[model samples]
Target: MSELAVPGIAYGGDYNPEQWPEEVWAEDVRLMREAGVTMVSVNIFAWALLEPREGEYDFSRLDRILALLHENGIAADLATPTAAPPAWFFRAHPDALPVDRDGRGLSYGSRQTFCPSSPAYREAALRITGELAARYADHPAVVMWHIHNEYGCHNAECYCEASAEAFRGWLREKYADDLEALNRAWGTTFWSQWYYDWDEIIPPRATGAVPNPAHQLDWRRFCSDELLSLYKAEREVLRAAAPSVPATTNFMVMYNFDALDYWRWAPELDIVSNDHYLQSTDPESEIDIALSGDLVRSLAGGRPWLLMEHSTGAVNWQPVNRAKTAGELRRNALAHVARGADGIAYFQWRAAKAGAEQWHSAMLPHAGTDSQIWRDVVQLGADLRALAEVRGSTGTAKVAIVWDWNAWWSVELPSQPSGEVRFQDLVRAWYEPLWRAGVAVDFVRPDADLSAYRVVLAPSLYLVDDEGAANLAGFAERGGTLAVGFHSGAVDENCHVRLGGYPGAFREALGVRSDELFPLLPGEPVGLSEGGTASVWSERVRLDGAEAVTSFASGPLTGVPAVTRHTHGTGTTWYVATLPAPSTLADLLDRIRTEAGVTPVRVTPEGVEAVLRRGEDADYLFLINHGDRSAEVEVPAGAADLLAGKPVEGGTVTVRAGDVVVVREPR
Candidate 1:
């Protein structure tokens, strides 16, 4: 499959020409040319304007917008405009609106208020998509189809009657209409929750007590499937009408509000794309950005993916809305490129004159083209053009981190072992060290192929089915080093304990079994045998064949194994019994990396990132310095810095803070 339809890195972003007058479009195009903008995502939220009433369609504004974009030599990532249904449609079909867990119907005015299972909403959405595809399928400016805006951003789950009925139907198909099987899987017999018929099965609603864990799990699965079904319906229409244009929907990969399982959704997309906004509040937001990019690239199966949306400056939604510092914007853009993004797009072209996002930053800020944001945009555009040869290049990684959304949901469900045990935090605890060590890492699903990786890190997995457990064991048995962190392999898919032991399915592979879990109180930490302390959670592990690498020096779990390593077949399995401090975690990973013989792409001092991207004939090393002082980075001999146009025959390159250097070497 083709990576991107455009020539260079796709630039520009969400453009809403329908929001402004016609005269402003000419100036918009002029500014786009001045800024070297190559593409724009248009008509994302124009449903109200596109269809004022049922069966009524208008394309006059859209036609002019596309024509203007083509005239300015800008490609269009055309949107289906189904994210926000028209107010009139919702008024006519109130059943389409979503209801919260309290059973209160959500009103229009905000985007993504329609329930995924509403038949009326589905019909209207598909009808408009057909109209859109029929009109612009062959347009010269349209390069790709941007299906509905971020799916399930607001109302991922609905407790309304329509959704309840749909949920029952989905369950019937999944269980083959066998209530006995459903009862056994859900363990409904535990609390008199057994069902005699499908109709008796409703979505876990707002009960004072905790809902059935199995029901909640299935409800999440069903909701994700429903959203995927909607995307498929529109994708089929676009495929029939405009088979040439690839279709994609923007994914919020690392966002807190994500509902759809992106692993399942990635297969439905013709091109993998994601929308990532920086968290200004977190000092480590850059790390999150890199993580998200790696995940999306992995979702594309090591192919170049598109960065569908990022902010040019401060996002209006955050509490503080802090603007990007002087060189931060440029660094942020290049970080995505270093990971494997063929496109760097933003949330908007022009700042909204009036809306919820009126204060949001755009390529052309409200200050016009005279602002710093516009200058940065133009500079990034030029940089991307100069590095056009980097397009379609891929990054290689020998390290894989297992990330599963089901595991995330299961670990965070109510009544777990520890309320403070966050899945993302645990994963990041392992990822940050690898990132700092200049190691290229891929985020893989639990069932992903493990042969390609020499080392795999699974942190706080908490939920693993039989197939997933076997996959891990196979990886270890086949000469791959595996690291399993605390709380993994505890439960089956239905949130039921595996019944044999803690770390249930993986007990044999890990060669360690836990008898009890001890969660520490805040500010309390147990000393590790290696001279550091472990906190948050600790397990009393008894080793079968594994040798203890680190043991708890004090506390209730004193002298127990805090970290252990066992050899199985030709590989080694390492288990972490508690969350170690940052320094200790890095030390542990460094030892594992060395033992696995996994080489870093480039080793540099702290605060500097080195990533290698390989093309057909050339390899590019991207060196980014995130620290305040200059750092010396060792580069390949006879390499030429692409940005500076200088040869680095000295074998070391000095990079200043907040700057990026791309070293080009002949493959």
Candidate 2:
């Protein structure tokens, strides 16, 4: 944020000139220039090349790559090449192989194959990183140091002695030699899982034992800590050498690895970055992308994050590999900026000649710059550079949505009464409506400050750590409008039901308690909105201190409290007991919007999503046409679309499908 140095929105992605011969390097540079790529990430997976055998070093190729990027006037997003130890090194030190969850030693066939706790792996990684940092720390072209690639896998850590010792140390720090407390916390009494001693706690093995969710979850947490330690080690070395350059490790968005606790690790990085690849095709797609981007932005306290990796076109890994339409890319890119993105970079710059990613799309397909994808990339780069002045643009959201990863992890660990009640689906059903209407929203942890937000929405908030619950109580008591949805406040952090009532600690705030819940099947109509019956998952509610705002129309508990509102100290809490249809949700949001005095960014004619971002000096409103048909939007009197350089004052703004029009409004 300090404006001492650095340009806005540097562009480019992983470049592997080492994979191709020198002849292709010229074409790569030419095409990169054509596409306006101002940055290049180099040496991402070159550990073997850097250190051929033991105690030997080679930088000839890396030197050429750096020189090439600089020669082409592109900044370097340099990598330490520690992601994978080379095949030769692995062959030399077979003990460096990672151990699977089931206790089998893995062969080095894929990347992400090194055990985090392995001393051999650590020492070698440090040597490589130290060398790379020492050499490139002073390079003028280097802008940032990318620590590593995605740092997660289900088969993390190992039963090998190294990992076991590390796990013991982790437990010692957390439990302080109280193994009994650990057993109790894990609910080990059910299957006689109580451990007599800490050593008795073994890593989950596929062949020898039945799965234990608690132990599995704890293992995941420990593995994450181990990887964090690894990243910190590299980060420290890089920092000591080049303290001014930013450093980061790419994060998997909405990832469930490690009890979903990204908030814990986000602060360690200089800037937040994530890979976004969702498999949904709806008007809400942009919203989904925005929510994830908002989550990252919120993690940084409204600072911008980088879109480190996204598919340029269809990825071969998905169940359905659908190429994005011409305008889909631009819309999605702007969506990132709309939420708070400083940069947009794809998974790869060039499609692989032969590999798992061969079929994956790229900015330049196999045909290079002649491809249509390259044309899109060129245009996107131009637009972004032109708009770079707004790199740190901030958006003000009157509404705050509370998302608790602990609750998500704890709820899924238990075999729920039915699989129909999923954590993610419930959240989407509740959040989609507010998002579609172009409401500026923040995704914060339950413990985040709520005094700044006018409206607070908590969806499927099953986990309530004591401090988090207290924060919620304070927020509601201090005059904030709270919305509580289905399966919320049902249990404490330990997954134990609150002794006093069904709604648990939030009962006083919500002013309601229920003895039973009704789960409806798909296609089954459980209630009605304003005009017709609404289908899908619905819950029956009983009111205590709250009054019914709406009721089920035809269920057994018909005309009962489907939705209730309770008055707190200076605010009101609305409890929605079921998953309502989209229209019904929009209606509820409309009410909240009115009560909170939260205005939509704009009032468009039709088929346009209105977005507004406010920076230190300027505020820009975006009119996005997400539909197939052209949309005619009516802007405020003296506004002009910055992207189009056109003014719309006579109440008419036209936009084509997937078109994004940025309107700069005078403050």
Candidate 3:
């Protein structure tokens, strides 16, 4: 399939002309032209307006919107508006409404209220999609097909009768109608939960006790598959009507509650796109923005990706709704571009007059074009145009962090070693140090090829399938550096214990065996022999063939290996028995970097991120200062700063706080 066919970096964002009067649209286009907006996503939430009544459709308003955008020289990222079905359809077929885990029906006031398994919802969604695709296929404005927005966001799982029947049918196909296989996989004999037939199984709801681990795991997989089925249904119609137009749906990566497996969904998209909202509560929101962008690029298999939606200022959803500081918005958008996002856009073009997200920020805020937010938006658009040659370039990384949705599901299952052992926390714990070190890292699945990376980090990977285990082992045997953090490789894909010891499949590769897990209490920490502290979790490790690099100084597991290293073939494996302090992890990574012969792109003070994006003819180094104070950074000699339009002679360059500088060098 062709990639999203757009020249340069496609800018602009979701434009809901339906929400405003017809007179307001020309003004929107005029503002878009002034802001260097190249594209606008339209009709995302217009289902109710497009078809106000059942079997009745209206395109007059939509046609005008598309024509206006085209006449203003802006491409259209056309949406199907199927995310929120018309209220009439829900009223006609009440079964299409989803049910909560407590067996209560969800009302139709919010979007994504339809059940994925409901045949009525699927049919209606497809019909609307087909109509939109057929009408807009030949339109000059349509550049890409934006499928239903953020699938599996609100309605990830449903316990209604329709979903229950679909779940049984899915199980039958998965188990080949064999109840014995399902029983064995779920280990039902222990709980007397053995099923006699497919109909006996139901959606894993609030059982008296914790649901079966295997059952919950399968339910998660089933829910993800059901949503994928719905996306494919819409995508098929779009493809049939508009074969040349690339189709994509925005993904909310690591949003915690989203269960749609992006690794499974990435293959179905022509171009990968992601919607990232900063965690205003966390000070490390910049790190998260870069992390999500890198993951999306990796999901695109190193191809360029789109930053589909972010915010220009304060988002209404967060508790505090903090607005962006002076230059933070520009820095945030450049961070995505530096990491490999070809296009940058936001959640809206204009702030809404009346809606749930009325207070949300936009290119044109409530204060209009004179506001600082609008000024920053226009500057970002001009900057994108200035660096247009960077489009289609890719970031180079010698480090990879393994990310698996199945493992994320398994580690967070109830009855774990510690409630504090969250998947994202563990990942961020390991990711923070590398990110601080200015090391460009790519996120890869356990099964991804490891030959290109010198270092691979797998943190809190509780479930490691046999194939993934073999892949990791082979990566180590082939002379790559491997780091396995706490509680990794403990269970199989079925959530069954690996039986021999803790960190079951990785014991041989890591050359260590864990006998017991000791979760630390809050504010409690154990000292490491290497000087820093380890907290949150610790394990009693018995070194088999590995050397203890860091030993626990004082704790119940004192004298055990807090960190160990083993040499296999030409490679080395490091096993972290606890969550080390950031300084400790940084020191450990420095050592690993030395052993792997991986050099940093450039070293700078804290809050300054350095990354290099290599194109066919030029290499661009992005230096972003995320601090509150200005900092000086070292640059390579004879490189020209693209943003400043000047040459730097391999000396120190002062970068203001929350500012970005791109240095272009000959490849």
- Clash counts for the predictions, in order: 0, 1, 0
Each prediction's whole-model lDDT (CA): 0.89, 0.77, 0.89
| lDDT string, candidate 2, 109-151, tens digits | 6687877788888888888899989999998888888897877
Candidate 1, clashing residue pairs? none
Measured with C-alpha atoms, the lDDT of residue 482 in candidate 2 is 90
Candidates in descending lDDT order? 1, 3, 2
Top-down TM-score ranking: 1, 3, 2
Which residue segments of model 3 deviate by more than 4 Å?
Answer: 649-652
| lDDT of each residue in 388-455, candidate 1, tens digit only | 87888998899999989899988888988788889888988999989999888998898888888999
lDDT tens digits, residues 486-567, model 3?
Answer: 8889999899999888779999999999888888998899998879898998888999899999999988987988999999
Weakest 10 consecutive residues of candidate 2 by summed lDDT: 1-10
TM-scores of all candidate predictions against the true structure: 0.98, 0.93, 0.98
Q: Residue 145, candidate 1: how far off, in angstroms? A: 0.4
